[model samples]
Target: MRVNFTIEGPPVGKARPRVTRKVTYTPKKTSQYEDLVRYTAINSFDGCFDHDEPVDVRIVAYFPIPKSWSKKRRQLCLINKELPIKRPDIDNVSKIIMDGMNPKMKRNKQLHRMVEVMRGIYHDDKQVTTLVVKKRYAERPRVEVRIKRDMGD
Candidate 1:
């Protein structure tokens, strides 16, 4: 199955450390990442997916280009070493998307190994999250193998 939709929110990462206190720390329950996941899970059609098997997830993150950047950079007219680097790396964003699908995913299965995820980013005028999920199958690459035999044999 395929799910194509956009999520509007600031992308979050899992790198943040838990609160250090004597009281209980609800690590898995509260965080910006978790909040976004909760929101997405409720809105996304991702619930329709049956996660009893492996799935391939492809998501693209589009971040708003900083207005502070020079006109040349914004227009892509200057091709220099200056990169359009942004917070929350592609991998982190992908993780957030997977976590958002946690409710639909079976916990008994090793989610990481079973999931084939792909991610990308683009600096644009809008902040958007595009997600796509589909079934994964074995499509082994074709390789030609040949054996040599003696003519006299």
Candidate 2:
């Protein structure tokens, strides 16, 4: 089937902005797996924004799941898995990120806030499949903190 839609723009100055048209086509009975694959490919960039920065740190948390899972399910799994890292009283989000780091390193407020924003993005349980952190090498942040869940027999 073919779908066409128009996006109307807000009025500016004395003239109305022209509307833009979008078109989409889909085949019949496509598997939900196709959506999952597309979602994974699109989101693969989430944790990779700062990868090339020499002074920046990057951490990646990978969950054991295939692309067949929906985006929401993946995010929920990440949130449920990483909930222990959340902080209650910190006004600045970066503090939470630093707090999530290894306690051995002295806490830096900036690092902590970065982690908090990253964590907050994943709180929805629909946007994340894994969480990764990248930081400067000097910080020596902990690479892995496992969250265990028991499946009852």
Candidate 3:
């Protein structure tokens, strides 16, 4: 089984700058970043799964290329299916998504582990992140048993 969801917005990365007040220092998610993750996860995961199942998470991040880029570069990107090899690094992107999914996965016994992850970048008209969760293994028997009682072969 595979679960799928798409969040359309600028992907929020995990890098957080720390702020110090006199003596104490605190690290927090940026307001914009926090809102982005919360809004997407809550809305998308709501009423999605009743039980947790083990999953191998896969993420494809489609980043929008700005119009500021030279026409030659833009055309090349569009024609060749170019990757967005720019900011909001891969690990940071993963962190944001994983945090959002915590509440949903915590409750389910079936979702014991998220075994694997594959991440990538691609060019698209708009910024979007697609999440694909695949079951770790087939729980049911793959082959059907046939009875020989009728045909005695």
Q: Which candidate number maximizes lDDT?
A: 3
TM-score, every prediction? 0.50, 0.15, 0.49
* Per-residue alpha-carbon lDDT of candidate 3 for residues 32-123, written as tens digits (9 for 90 to 100): 45345445544544333223222344655555666587777766665544556666777667655555444422223477664323111211
- How many clashing pairs per prediction, in order? 0, 23, 1
Off by over 4 Å in 1: 19-32, 77-83, 104-153
lDDT of 2 by residue, 62-97 (tens): 224335767776566555542222222222222233
Candidate 1 per-residue lDDT, tens place, 84-125, comes to: 355666566665555554532222364544332311121110
lDDT of each: 0.40, 0.27, 0.43
lDDT of 1 at 110: 48
lDDT of 1: 0.40
Every model: Cα RMSD to truth = 16.1, 23.2, 15.8
- In the predicted model 1, the residue pairs found to clash are none
Q: Relative to the unseen true structure, what is the C-alpha lDDT of residue 152 in candidate 2, on a scale of 0 to 100?
A: 22
State which candidate, 1 or 2, has the greater TM-score: 1
